[model samples]
Target: KAAGSALMKNEKLVEDIIKSVVNAVNIPVTLKMRTGWNEENKNAPTIAKIAEDNGIKMLAIHGRTRAQKYNGDAEYDTVKKIKGIVSIPVVANGDITSAEKAKKVLDYTGADAVMLGRATQGNPWLVGQINNYITTGKTSKAPSLDKKISLILKHILQIHDFYGHKMGTQLSRKHIFWYSMHLDQEKGSDFWPNINRVSNHSEQYLKFHDFLYSI
Candidate 1:
């Protein structure tokens, strides 16, 4: 839906803006963009060259075009094409769920780097794990059940502190949902809709602890 009317839909205008910002700033300027407005207009290569010509220091492209909106597997051919067309560093993004997938994307696209977004919601340590594997070619052990439960609780509390109780609890619902998605695989399934309904900090903690102690 958003892809149909992206703010950066006009390539020429966006290129002009990038040129102005590049000329105006002393610091490096980077551009992040989708493949195009839709499948018919996968103009990532065109925009990558424009940014390079306009002095962008780097380019990061999500493998899925704007229209795809994370519905399917990310395609690396476009990123590879963009890298071929531009001399500046290009980073590939999308569906990099694990360290192995990260390595696979880098190897397939020959991208200068890889980026993560949705994969890091409650699993922030994934970045460290991915980095360790990428740099050392050795897999790190997954966090223990107790450690993961502790981390999820800590994460909810951090959000509560940062956003204040009301907004934080509301914002935390999705994070808790994602966290539970992983937890269900390990622990015997139980808390779900019941757990997500918890909005207040005290109640959330109570329910979380109950879920943990029960199993």
Candidate 2:
């Protein structure tokens, strides 16, 4: 719904819809959005005000314009600006790949929170690490090689069970690759192609287990 607003080019309709959705549901309504449709059209502050006025409980702004997608550095100037405009809890999101970066984002934007997207794909522990570091100024210990392998093994089996054998393996492939990427950084991404070749679930599990532990 957020992405659709840029294409529709009508924040008013989006606002109306947001109002309707908020009025219709008992739960609080929240919003997530990029800076705007393009660099010149950074209307985040305007949108933030609209959302707040219409009873949005919280707002999450990705620090990039829609045109940039994942390219370029995320621009937090708008997030900082929006934080000043809206009274609701504001979340700043973009390029937060480490604990210090998350802290910097929160401090710079004066946002209520910092959000992570792609950074937590395989290293889900990062969420806790960043939080603990930010709150306590103590870095959470990264999992050792042995602990990482155990986590990876458990993750794949859970994925396999949730989606079942057929769809689960298909879904698990990309995640398996992500976990592999970090674990085998010394070996390089050549490891991914090897994982892609294993089609069977048991075979894939064994491959992930062996490959991750070997690292």
Candidate 3:
């Protein structure tokens, strides 16, 4: 988790892992890491150096210290410094929720690219949206109501396929909460208590559709 050390603390341990991965494969190697262990122990530059000293071709930096977690705005200044110190491509991550934010991050951090996390949870189309804007300088049309419903169904099916019925259904409930909140602004905290009472995936899906229909 974010509370733990960013990547593993032992430098040799990481080198060994990278060496093994490099030996096992014929292509480039990359690593993902947070700003550092905590506010005081922000060793991202050191870690980036260690990774570079090894064969890592790229490094992605999540711009929050372990102590910060997801509570505050990501610190792009640290990422900027990492880019200054490291020769490999540096990717920035954390709270990149929109194309505008993505562009700002790339410019601010001076990273080769930006990584999107929670922003893509229910909005995977964002990747294409960002690409369209970056390439064409225009945003795409919003998805139609019918497309939104279909995407909800598709997401449910994918979750069900990846995780079995019981677990998938359980996990889908949280996503359903997010969908409910986004699709129908009126359904606020009041809907969450009943979410646990929904019997199964079919019932939950039906409830969601009914809620959407009411909107």
Maximum-TM-score candidate: 2
By lDDT, rank the candidates, best first.
2, 1, 3
Candidate achieving higher lDDT, 2 or 3: 2
Q: Which run of 10 residues does model 2 get worst, by summed lDDT?
A: 1-10
lDDT of 3 by residue, 1-215 (tens): 41245454566666777788977998998998888767878888888888888789999988888778788888888899999998899999988888888887888878898888787765667888777777787888658867887888788878877987788888888787777666665673566676657868777767766766666
lDDT of each: 0.82, 0.85, 0.79
Clashes of 3: 0
All predictions: root-mean-square deviation over Cα?
2.8, 1.9, 2.8
lDDT of 1 by residue, 65-91 (tens): 777777888889999999888999999
Off by over 4 Å in 2: 1-8, 186-188
- Clashing residue pairs in candidate 1 are none
**List of clashing residue pairs for candidate 3:** none
Model 3 lDDT at residue 54? 79
